[model samples]
Target: MPATFSTLAEFRTLLTHAPKIDAIALGEAQDRNGQLTKPPGALGRLEDLAIWYAGWRGTARPSIDAPQVIIFAGNHGVTAQGVSAFPAEVTEQMVMNFQHGGAAINQLSKAAGASLDVHALSLDVPTQDFTQTSAMDEAGVVDALVAGWNAVAPHTDLLVVGEMGIGNTTSAAAIAHALFGGQAEDWVGRGTGVDDAGLANKARVVREAVALHAGGDGLDTLMRLGGRELAAMAGAIAKARSLRIPVILDGFICTAAAACLAQTQPDALDHTVAGHASAEAAHRALLAQLDKQPLLALNMRLGEGSGGALAINILKSAVACHSGMATFAEAGVSDA
Candidate 1:
């Protein structure tokens, strides 16, 4: 289905209304964790992650099932500025690759026993160059976001969002600069392994775009600079939170979307997790803004949701440890 939005303000209201996680479940989950067979805190962050899910799902013993990775595919007109190593058509090619099960995310998701879906957005049109004008106006953004939100609505247990857009890092950096008030050089990264020349061009393009939209509000900044995929992910994250689902973000571009949602609603990241730390320089700063510690550090810069696919096993492990293990009483083991 195509995306639709009544207005920018109305869409913002939908995003901000995603319900907060239930804290009462947190206490019960923690108490159950303390009574588990393992010593207190022995499992460390795994225990913490399990409890975090418990609060979101409102389940004392949260279990992960039917984990799905949805990759949003779009093309950025900003590539005309030489921001990425690949050309714009590669976005369409990669989307085709995903459909044919020839991409890294396909292999990773299969190995993890998770489902993978790809949404091809703007197959015929790239977002207009934001350095000149808005990549997508409020109406366009609403359509993209609604598509993403519906793509994610089917799965309630675990959702991982990845992107397949060329030049998206530049768009993400522009959003970071607007929302975080940072210089473009600090936010731009060597997307797709750009060389020295391409890196300078990427930074320059981002800086120019950020300047174009300076002093604009958050939604305005996003509409001006952020592309369709990022808008979709932000909407999906917010909507998933409303459904009490946990979202694992893929890499820098995906995290940038999460950062947008968090900037809009501070508690938005409460139900989110960083799949891994990207090799992208700006990703660390973006994660810091959301206060999310990644579950992996594979030094990956690929953006096809590969990192998120890898991290799905870790989340499943947390679920297994939380639900499968027996308590001291059930195991007939007494504490000394």
Candidate 2:
């Protein structure tokens, strides 16, 4: 698929017209689920998950064999405000760790049989401090979005987009606060193990940034308050929707990025499911706002797609039960 969007307005138009899930296939999957050789509704959410996945793949029986996990890393200029416990250089270092397959995400993706790819979005050029200016200009945001759009490989049945950026939680908080109309304190949290004082400072930074750069449309808000990694995640999610690939969203930062799309087009996130809820205090609130119930909640706060990768097995099980189970008629089992 062509991943080029020359401008944010053009992208917005595309989002407005993104394809809907296959209702015919969804109906077929529901009928198939009814014929499976098991008690009705015994599989619970697994049954629902299977049907949802089938709708996106446009198949009555869908299998999640080609799951792709992409990690986008970028340096954050807001780290200059001491918003994060780690330095901005950690973004590049962690990208190297991912490349070397030493990160938690790498291990989880491998265990889940997913193909992992890491993209560092100009690690040397951190985004501008949103407290003073927009994080990225129109051209820059488009470039980042295009990078994410092209990162997704063809024939990927499922997608998980993660992020690595110091001070990004601050960016995510600002985006959430701006888009959702909440107090900065309500949106900010201790990211990367920041202490009480650091958390307070993070909230203050979010307030300042939102005060300066709020009230624009979703894409504009992203260009103002979102980092490259966040924008890239949004781009990838949108791309997944365009390609009819189901998405499993990660944590707070990833959710915040996806929330931007929701703010743009309310139905833009229909193809996605919350893979896991992060330990971030605002994640649950954000998920509630998005009405996405997470598939897992292990009190995980680690980013780099660790939680989403771990949840892949859950999706695979759902798919397997949906596709691999023998129908009552096929098995010569009594339906009644």
Which has the greatest lDDT? 2
Q: What TM-score does model 2 achieve against the real structure?
A: 0.99
Best candidate per TM-score, number? Answer: 2
Clashing pairs in 1: none
Ten-residue segment with the worst summed lDDT in candidate 1? 1-10
lDDT of each: 0.84, 0.93
lDDT of 1 by residue, 1-336 (tens): 223456777766766776778889989998888889988999999999899988988889888878888889888888888888888888889898999999999999998888888998876899998989889977788888787778874555898888888889899898988889767889988888888888888888988888788775566766788888888787777667768888888998998877776677667688888899999998989888778899999899898889988999998999799888999989999964
**Per-prediction TM-score:** 0.96, 0.99
What's the lDDT of the predicted structure labeled candidate 1?
A: 0.84
lDDT at 195, model 1: 89
Candidate 1's displacement at residue 96, Å, is 0.7
Tens-digit lDDT track of model 2 for 240-275:
999999999999999999999999999999999999
Name the 10 consecutive residues with the lowest summed lDDT in model 2. 210-219
